[model samples]
Target: METIKISVIIPSYKPQNYLWECLESIQVQTMPQEEFEVILILNGCREPYSKAIESFISKHPAGNLTMLQTDIPGVSNARNMGIDNARGEFLTFIDDDDYISPTYLQELYNIAKDGITPVSNVIAFNHVTGQYETNYLTECYKHLYNKDKITIMQARSFMSVPVAKILSTNAIGIRRFDPEFKVGEDGLFMFQISNRIKILKAASPSCVYYRRNRDGSAINSLRPRGQRLKNNFKLMTNYTKYYLQDIRHYNIFFYISRLVAEMISMTFAVRGKIQQ
Candidate 1:
């Protein structure tokens, strides 16, 4: 009956091979089992995945683990469902394919409890390559070393993409991932929330994000050059229109430059010039 401090929302889609490790990491958290709730959103997966998650939850009844199913098919919809059903003060998003350290929740909880607003840590490991990458915190510090006034937009612009970050679910208001975008949903979601919330960087490498390298993975399978370019363009336009509305002086130019950079990257990705 006690209130939970963190709600870990994992949006799973056909993650049978990887879900166990992800769940195991959460189960072994250094934080008290009572302090957090793990909510798995099984978005439009077949019975096998649902049964697997259900069985795991049944065995670990001591922890507050809940499995919810939705016929709605995208990762965005699944994440949005998790947000609606969450009962914790702070929310942390973990991909079904990634694993977190035992102290992940406790560290995030400590910062959030101290009123850090929106805080995110460094995500180590690229899910696609299965190799560790430099922590985002280190990257951010390098850009604005020993400087304050680290605005959300600046952090977001520098981070490039946002995943594996802990955020105050309520302070940013009840915002959900834009259901339309499939590829850049995380980036757009971060951009939208950055406008309203003050985000703090937790300088730690705590989360292991596994970037899937297989051909069948969502990122790899999305297809033709033209379609991919169109989607990326749409993502940039929608994100910019919603978040960066000030439109003054050189800031506008910088915003357009970032979007252009993203477009160029997408062009290379689609043309097989660079591997995403």
Candidate 2:
């Protein structure tokens, strides 16, 4: 009868061999099991993976893992289901392929206890290329090294991928993911949260957010420029609904710019596909 402090929502769909490692990382958190729970959503998975996961759960009954199955096709739908079933004070997202560090939960829990969205510096481990990426998100996050807490309004350019972050349940309330856009849905979800809540800095590098550069097996590897453009249009459509609601919303300017950029991208994508 322990009150759950953080609910680690892992929405997995046709995951890689690294999924077991991802679940294992959560199992070994320094934080007590009573203080946290892992909600592993089996998103539209078929036999072998589903059977393997069932067996995996049975062997490690001490982790307080809750398995929820859904025939829903998208990660957003899976995550929305997680939010509905979450019995925690806060929510943290973990991709099935990404294995976190031992202190990942403890560090995030410490910050989440304060009612702020905790964002940490992540190690983007590309197991395929054997390279660790240092993108613009990492570069901008470095600027927060001197501070402990930050207002999301001030740090608008901060990465909103829903990774390396923990958010309060009340802050997220009933806001479900827009399942239309396959790509950038996480970022869009984070942006909506940012508009609604105060974001804090937990920039200390903790988790190794593993990204495998595999072939068509990966969700990211399946899309082409045309597909990306179509998804971006869908993303902007959802974003525009939020944008028009309040023209004065803190990140409205960024939203408009993003919408315009998506338009340009769609144009290019259409022309490119036509030439093909």
Candidate 3:
């Protein structure tokens, strides 16, 4: 058997409408089939969707795909399952609703092999409007190369989101997702690993992240203001400790201020929704 260099981890819920396209994109990746494996973690999906995913996997070339079923109810749990089950030297988290360009995996693989610890590329589309949004660290990242030494602040800022990045699961070690944090688990996971991992940013916009806008979709619905505030407070607390431990005091206050502002805005957002 050929060795697998990359493991694509996809956490899926009842995303029947989008899973086929997402799987198809992976099957057609420009990276040769022998180079990578796709692991689909199906959390709380009904039998019908499971059967569909199975059927798709059966038709694919051997040794390229595997599907695991988990009773876990949240995305965080599903992602953690992926992390635990991943067998590739490099692991990637791709959302079930998103589809990548054919060159996405190959591009990420090329940069990752350059000895960068955690490498991430640009997410080109929001999947709602088919447009890209500027990330918080895009400008700062422009100054850093694939092999440059990165401060904890730079790593934290760059790794704010787990998606759009390909990481060496073996280098920094696989950090499981926090199942308790449904809102900012990805951010928290990235924050925890940023300190121990070197950073690399890919210059391509090949990853297409699709944000579903339908009502009740995880990305669409808003939680209570109190809940949002609580989550933000926890994230800030965690981020502060992570930064302070790494001696990046400059970014600590920035995180606090951003948390406060987001909390305030969330309050008004909740009120507006209630009024509507």
Candidate 4:
């Protein structure tokens, strides 16, 4: 068997046919199917989801796909399973609901094989409006635009998403998501990876990250008043601890600012609940 050049991990729950469409995008990639593998992680689903994924795989044998089912919940655990099972030289993640262009895998693979990480243009597509957009985050990090090599400092300071980057398997070897964090887990994982490797941004937009305009479908979905407070506290504590060590600046003021910001956000959140 030919060595797998790339491994794309998609962790999904009951995403309906959205997962199937996401798989279709990969099926049409410009790269050779044998060179890359797709690992679909079905997290905490019963008969219908299992049946659906089995049906998807049987229809698309050219996908070179491997589907794994885990009874354990959470995207974190699902992703961890992907990391453990992957057999490719380079790795990247795509949300089950999102789809990429035909050139997505090939373009990023070309950059990554030469020992440079490749970050792509993330087009946030409104599933409802059928609108695609590259927002201000890319503009704000203009230094990374059209570049093939990026320093840790440049990567650290800029806001980035895992979907935007294809990383070396060696670079991400054994790095697992913190099961403790339901939110901000992906962010922290990216932050940790960028700190350890050189990342490059792909020249053009190649992925359509579908965002539906719906409540309860996002990471920040509103929770019950008491549960919300606990989750918020966990989020704050993790961020504070991470930033305290992450603040590379010598100035004490910047460190203090992060703490203050977290506190202020928490205060207003609780205040809003009280007022309600």
Candidate 5:
């Protein structure tokens, strides 16, 4: 049997209509089907959702696609399950609501190596407006437009999300999501993974991950300020602990300070909005 070069992990909970589009995008990737495998984990909700996904997989026929359903509700847990079952040498994550360009996988895979990871441009697509716009992540990509390779500090924004990057399995070995966090988990996970990666290669700009910006989405949904602050505290505490151990490998201090600054700025912004 041939080795699986990439494992695409997608975790869904009460997935919306967009899940089909996400699956469709992967099915049409330029990468050969045999070189990659798709692991779909339906968490929290089962039965109808699982049956629907299973039926779609059967009909669409993307080679090496596996669907797993778990009682766990969080995306982090579902992704952890996918990681445990993955056989590919490299792994990439895609949210169930978002899709990627046809060349996303192939472009990232071309530049990926043991100590080097590849980053792709992220495009924010407004589901309601049917418009595509540049987001903070896209700006981060532009910051490195002139460079071929960079460090975690250079592509700091990449640390915040797992999407739009191809990571070596060895780099991610034994590290899993901190299930306790509903927010900032991606950043912390990537921060941990960065310890093993020596450099990050910028993939072609054409390789894009279409991030859907819609109401009630994780990014758009607003939680209670107390909950947000609590999660933010936990995130900072975790980042601090890891930085103390791998201070030379990653500029985690930057993340810690920036997160604190963002929180302060956000509080002011909300206050200003209310005053107006």
Candidate 6:
């Protein structure tokens, strides 16, 4: 059997036509097919969606790709299953609507190390405008342009999201996304796995993750201010628990201050929401 260098996990729920573009991008990676595996999990919805996905797979043949289905709805649950079945030494995540540049996987694989996480630049592709723009996270990652690596404390801001990054399987171990959190699960999952990551490295500028910025997408969806605050509180509790354990090398003072700021901001946000 060929060695799988990386595994790309895509958790798709009630997907749209954009899924085909995402899959096609992966199908044409710069890396050879045998070097990586793509695990696409169709979660929550079934029947027509499953049949549609099956048809897509049949039409576009990829020997390295594997499609799995589950009645579970949460993206975190689907990702957990992907992690459980991942056969690669390194792992990266891609949303069903997002796609990566041709050299994305190869670049990530080249820079990935047991104690390091390689991050890619995220480009927001406007669906309607047909234009690409620099995303907020990509702007935050500018600090990495000249440096070789930085600690989790330095990369904390942008590290909140799991996209545009590749981590080693050994680094991830058994840490999984918290299914309880629908809002801040990505940040919490990154926090859980941060214990093993000593440094963050930036991949080649060419290694880009094209994030589709469109209406009704999961990232753009909003919840009530009260619900968001509740989710924020739950995330704070989880973050505090992991930080207190001191297994990871992060600045406690910095983390505490961030939480304090978030509390104030959330309070004001709720007030504004109520006023409106």
Q: Write the per-residue lDDT of candidate 4 for residues 100-137, one digit (tens) a residue.
A: 77888888787776777766655555656667555544
What are the per-residue Cα lDDT tens digits for candidate 5 across 1-276? Answer: 355999999999999799999999999999998889999999998877988998898897756789998997998999999999999999999999999999999988988853568899888978999798768889998887658668777787887788889888888999999899877788789878777876787877899999998777776656666566566667767877887787887665555654674467457545643110
TM-score for candidate 2, residues paired by index: 0.85
Candidate 1 yields a Cα-based lDDT of 0.68
Question: Where does model 4 exceed 4 Å of error?
Answer: 1-3, 133-143, 156-160, 206-214, 224-268, 271-276
Q: Record all residue pairs in model 2 with backbone atoms less than 3 Å apart, i.e. clashing.
A: none
TM-score, candidate 6, is 0.91
Error of 1 at 245 (Å): 5.5
lDDT of 6 by residue, 215-272 (tens): 7777667678877787778778888888888734656655675477457757765776
* lDDT for model 3: 0.67
> Which residue segments of model 5 deviate by more than 4 Å?
252-276
Point out where model 3 deviates above 4 Å.
Answer: 1-3, 117-158, 171-174, 205-216, 241-276
Q: Between candidates 1 and 2, which one is better according to TM-score?
A: 2
Best by lDDT: 5
Tens digit of per-residue lDDT, candidate 2, span 102-135: 8877887776676666666655556677687765
Model 5: weakest 10-residue lDDT segment is 267-276
- Provide the clashing-pair count of each candidate structure: 4, 0, 0, 0, 0, 0
* TM-scores, all models, native as reference: 0.80, 0.85, 0.78, 0.81, 0.91, 0.91
TM-score-better candidate, 2 vs 3: 2
Tell me which of candidates 2 and 4 scores higher on TM-score: 2
Candidate 1 lDDT over residue span 147-235, tens digit each: 43455555654334545456776654766788987777776676566544554544344533333334566755545677677777897
The weakest ten consecutive residues by lDDT in model 1 span: 203-212
